[model samples]
Target chain A: MQAIMTLKQVNYQAENKHILHDINWAIPVGAQVTLTGPSGSGKSTLLRIMAAMISKTSGELVFDGQPIESYDPVLYRRQVSYCFQQPTLFGETVADNVTFPYRIRKQPVDHDHILAALEYVGLGEQTLTQPIVDLSGGERQRVALIRNILFLPRILLLDEVTAGLDEQNREIIHRWLRHLNVDRGVTTIMITHDAQEIAAASTLAKVVAGRLEVQA
Target chain B: MNLAVNNTSLFFAAMLVLVALGISLWQKLGLDKDIIVGVVRAIVQLFTVGYLLKYIFRVDNVWLTLAMMGFIIFNAAWNAKKRGAGIANAFPIALLAIFISTGVTLGVLILSGAIRLIPSQIIPISGMIASNSMVAIGLAFRSLNSQFHDQRQGVLERLALGSDLLDASIAIVREAIRTGMAPTIDSAKTVGLVSLPGMMSGLIFAGVDPVHAIKYQIMVTFMLLSATSLGSIIACYLAYRSFYNAQKQLK
Candidate 1:
């Protein structure tokens, strides 16, 4: 079966230092994979490369069998969403931030669908109209996640999404992530340092010193 | 009216020097030598322009007048570019905006016969409009570039959703224009109440009737408002375009 996403012998260098060396990894359609690594082990960098946020020095990246470079980067990014470690929400209101992608695309936003997405992420209806600055850290993360899911990307690349959340919020996010993967059949590739998150994921891949090691 | 440096002039000069000295001493609290150099440069440049204007007014040559206007536009562009580093192509955009805005406003004044097409009228009117537009364009360019940097990811996400570059940056561009023209808007709103305008004051000092001077001041202020608005909008649009690639995608 063709993988939903594939990285073959990918090597990346920055500032004359090798950041990612010979990374060969694949996420089959609908698979939930977690990447765990020590700080500066290139986990986030690997995700960035996969998301096409940065260019690789060598090798190939493929999305759904076609080379990633061939796919329009913007289109690929839309289909393959990348959630940063920190929740970055733009605009004054939560609704504004949520509807940003739709607004940019000139698509009419479905308020019902947006509310449903927020509800799924455990955010209340009130959150849609709240000022962005008023939202707590966990709320902001949920909002960011909601934005990603609202676009309904085929692949999700999350980088330490739950690092700053409390246990309760983390559990809430974990449940939603699992639901998205198992129920909706959305492919998820998450990078986290949390042992519990790694253990809970369907598959865990460890990276150390710029090399990938899959754990059965 | 005789042009003489009186006690008021000396007092004002002394006050300015004292302010400069205070600021220079305050540099100990993080003010650098560059600030002093900038003030010194401003004094030299203004004095030089004062001397040059004296001779230019006597000659009243159209070519010399136009040359000075071009110089103003060029300097405005240079300053805009200097302030808008990391956003290439800002200089030309600002230059075009200032040129078109000032030219249109000044042209209107000339066509209306409100101001004669002489060095005296064209020079001051053009200088005021061009300088105001310069500030507006500079602010617009700075705001647009900074907003682009801040919203890079948000912009990418929008593009991914199939939004065009212009669509993604429209909000930022609007914001830039608003910020750029804010000073002009404030000045127009508070004119005569907050302070006597330079144009009216200068005319009154030269023995022009207060009513006539008020008319000129009104025309100048309105022209500046229009020029600043136009320049800011044009510069912001061009600056927005500069952030994108040939394929109409954000770079």
Candidate 2:
């Protein structure tokens, strides 16, 4: 499979503090990679740079053979999605959160597709009509996950998506992520520290002291 | 004929009421120093302006008239810049808002012969416009800051989901402007009922024709509303732009 995303010599520095140094990686299409690291190690920062939520201090970042800066940021984000650690749902209803991709794109709301996406994440169609404020943490995370995939990004960047989830919900999320890779060929790059989570990945990478160490 | 000397004495008598207010504040709220200093500062500032305006009106040099107008606008903007302390180009933003609102309204009035460009006509009207615009812009900054703080998560989410800054903040910009202009709109709605307006009362006190005073008061109201609306919109736009950094991050 061709590389769907590539970062070369990426150095992220803030206030002379080196967060990530001389990082180089290429994520292949349909590959599931888990990035493991200690707390405050630059794992999430790398993911953010991949998601274009932040710019690298110095380096070349290419998405699908084009420079990241060449694409419209909004359009780039649509193609490569990022789900924050703590899911932030906007507006009142779950439907609002589910329908945001359409709203932002100025496209007609695909109600059937939204429901299907939620169902794939183990949420029933009825969840769409409910208020998001009342959802449990796991449910909110699931909703956030469904929201990110509704538009079908080429690559998914998840930041410790299951850190606080119970085993039941964690299994559900893991299953859906695998399904995305297997069925839709969605490239997944997740920042996680869970042993079982890291073990399931086809490729593993560890970040320590501002350097990326890829392990198979 | 117009009780000019008597009114001057009455103005001093008004100071006694202010003193009473200060004393009551001291006795009841322990705000003695604040009230005394505020009242004294107001007296000194107003008297100084009154003397300065008297001299400017008599001088009749066009450049000096324009220069005084600039000074008044600069003072108004300087006060408003503090309201948006974090906003980049805060002072320039305030200056632009004051200039546009006051300039556009005065331009129309001069064109229509409703007012001349003389110091006497320009100074008082410009003061009214600049002061009201300053307050409106300040409120715009305050509202912009608070709304962004409250909607931070939502904003970032939108940004991540492929929405540009303008798209994300359109609703917020409108909200800030509306909130900024709300006081002026509400005041306009309740004028003459809840209170006699300042210009009208002052004109009537000066023995101008009641009808003429009412006309001037109406003009002032229109000018104030227009100034506030325009000022708030400008300030809100500038304040909103300040939220994003060079990397388009909401810092």
Candidate 3:
């Protein structure tokens, strides 16, 4: 099995306080990994570091056998997409959020692709032109999910993506993630505090006091 | 030829008595002592500037003129930098913004022979250009800081979706520059109807021909618009980076 991302002795600190100390993890290609931990256990920080949103104080972060530092940060983020725990939507309309992938790549926004992605997320085709301000939390989360995956990134780092979703929406997102991994072979690193999500994950990594304990 | 400023004491005393009315009103309105302090500082500063200008004009060297222009820009940039204390390296950003605007505008005037690069023309004109640029940069900085703060999630989300730093901040940068330049644009629109600007009023009070003063004032407005637009754009571009880290995440 080939590893897609390898972290060795990762450490992060701010203002004389340690956030992550000596973290070592390997994310294999096409694997779905879930990170579970209590609040303030540095799970989100670890996820952000994985996404290259923030750099580690000291460590080697390698992606696809190349040091993450070797890749252009913008292109790296394009391949390794990071979704926040909160439903972070940009611009006024769902089209605005969904078309973001095309806008970044300097490619024309395909209306059909946007509509299809929205529909896949249980949103109607009419929802594409709808203003994000009018969206409920669950709808916003689904919109964000579709937005991140529209370009089909190699790795997806999701932080509490289903926290605010209803049971139906949660199941919708779960099926999407499963499809993304099984069908599309996209690598995933997710942070979830829910017991059911932890129990259901094929590979579980728990962080406690900035230490990782993997149980598969 | 220097214009005579006669009866300086009487003029100042009358001004003081007039401002006392304002102080009384401010006190009634529960305004703080900062107002009084500001007024006192203004008096001291103007008098000091008056003496310095007298000497500088008497010396009448190009180097002195350049020094005065530098001093004006530095002071203006310092004040502008304070408006966005949260931005890292704000003073340098403001200095660069003010320099670009003031330098390019004055360079055009000098190159076109619209104005002489001398103490009389360069000092006063560059002062206006620099100060206006200062205000524009301050507005740009504040707008950028607040926008990045309020729209943290939006900016970061865009980055995650593969938007480059420039692409992610395009809308915000546009808004910030517009916000910075709006006051100048609006003021120019309402010039004669709303209020007489300070430089025009000063020229008229000094007994210059009204038509001549009006021409100078028109020139001032055009120069200001040019400087402020450039300054705000530059400031926004430079300051936007402070909100993001090395990996393009919202800091």
Between 2 and 3, whose TM-score is larger?
3
Native-referenced Cα lDDT, model 1: 0.83
Better of 1 and 3 by TM-score: 3
Task: Mark the 10 consecutive residues where model 1 chain B has the least summed lDDT.
Answer: B156-165
**Model 2 stretches with alpha carbons more than 4 Å out:** A124-126, B1-41, B59-64, B107-119, B208-218
Q: Which digits, one per residue and each the tens of the lDDT, describe model 3 over residues B151-185? A: 87778778777788999898899999999999999
* Residue B12 miss distance in model 3 (angstroms): 6.5
Q: Second chain only: TM-score per model?
A: 0.88, 0.92, 0.90
In CAPRI terms, model 1 is classed as: acceptable
Q: After superposition, how far is residue B187 of candidate 2 from its true place, in Å?
A: 2.0
lDDT of 2 by residue, A1-216 (tens): 688888899999998899999999887877888989999999988988888778999999999999998987778988988888887897799998888788878889998898788888788988988998899999999998887888889999899999988999999999999999889889888999899998787899999988999986
- Using lDDT as the yardstick, the better of models 1 and 2 is 2
Error of 2 at A208 (Å): 2.7
Which number leads on TM-score?
3
What value does the interface RMSD of model 3 take? 1.4
Whole-structure CA lDDT of model 2: 0.87
- Best-matching candidate per DockQ: 3
lDDT of 1 by residue, B125-207 (tens): 88888889989988887888789988887776555444566777888999999999999889889989998899999888888
What's model 3's overall lDDT? 0.87
User: Where does model 1 exceed 4 Å of error?
Assistant: B2-64, B142-172, B240-251
The TM-score, computed over Cα atoms with residue i paired to residue i, of candidate 2 is 0.87
